[model samples]
Target: MKFLKYLLIFLAVIIVIIAILAFVAPTEVKVSRSITIDAPRETVWEYVNSLEDMHQWSPWAEKDPDMKLEYRGTEGKVGSVYSWDGDPETVGKGEQEITSIQAPSRIESELRFLTPYESKADAYVQLDETGSGSTRVTYGFESVSPRPMNVLNLFMNMDEMVGPDFEAAMSNLKKLVESGGSSGETQSEMAFR
Candidate 1:
């Protein structure tokens, strides 16, 4: 009986220590990653700005082929929305609404995740033409969590979790668009106004 009591006490103490550490951690997390693409700004913009064409090089979409997707807006202009429902652990599911867009230059969106955790984030992608037929693309996201999780997330890296996917998607966008064979590609450069 005494041995069982001691074991219980020890386990309780360990759990308490872990909870305390998580509470003391930072209250929010932010991550940003960028990569320059070997493609024209116009080419890269077309891939990201349009909801329908996202499938061509989207790293996550390809992850779950059976994921349900619904899109809104005209092709890729501003006010477009992309929503998907997928397996919780693998893709969880979210809706992204393009709030502002500046064709071949910048796009900002509100991303809301509904599984694992419910959170909203501001996501943006900007492209700067570096000449030599390349665009320096910067993708960034900021997420804020509440209370204990926020502090715990500070110790964890959201950028690390999400940045690799962004990097690969951008790379694929560069290759697909510049190579000039994607059916979604439009002849004219995207216009922001």
Candidate 2:
């Protein structure tokens, strides 16, 4: 009975400590990665402004070649949405909707993850002209986890978890744009069906 009493006290102390830590943890998590491409900002924007074009260089698409994709609304403008269903262990399932656009400079979107977990994030791509024909592209996402769940942020490094994928995708984008391999095709012409 003494051992059981001590064990209960230990577990209670651990839970209390975690709850206190949760109050100190950050509620918002942000992850970003950037890359410079040997292409003009406008040229780079052409590929990123549309979901279909972005898929041509997406690392997740490469991970699940047979992933199902669906599109709604207009292609490159605000309000467009791209949804994908893929390997849960890799790409999972999500939909991203274009929220705003500043042609040749930035595109902001809302990302909603459906499988593995349900969550929402604000995602953005920003482009800056670096030189005569060079552009620096920054891809990032931010999400807020409320209250107790924010405690996970203490144990998880969002940047480390998502940064490598962003790096690989940026590298792929750079190669695709530099080599002129993306084709700048319309969604109907290059659907992933």
RMSD of every prediction: 5.9, 3.5
Task: Please report the candidate that would top TM-score against the real structure.
Answer: 2
RMSD of 2: 3.5
What are the runs in model 2 whose C-alpha is more than 4 Å off?
1-11, 185-193
Model 2 residue 157 CA deviation in Å: 1.4
Give candidate 2's error at residue 17 in angstroms: 1.4
Tens-place lDDT digits, model 2, residues 1-193: 9999999999999999889988999999999899999989988998898777777777788788888999999998889999999999998999999999999899999999999899999999999998768999999899999988999999999999889988988988887777676546423334442
Scored by CA lDDT, what does every candidate get? 0.75, 0.87
Runs in model 1 lying further than 4 Å from the true structure = 1-24, 183-193
Q: Count backbone clashes in candidate 2.
A: 0
Candidate 1 has an lDDT of: 0.75
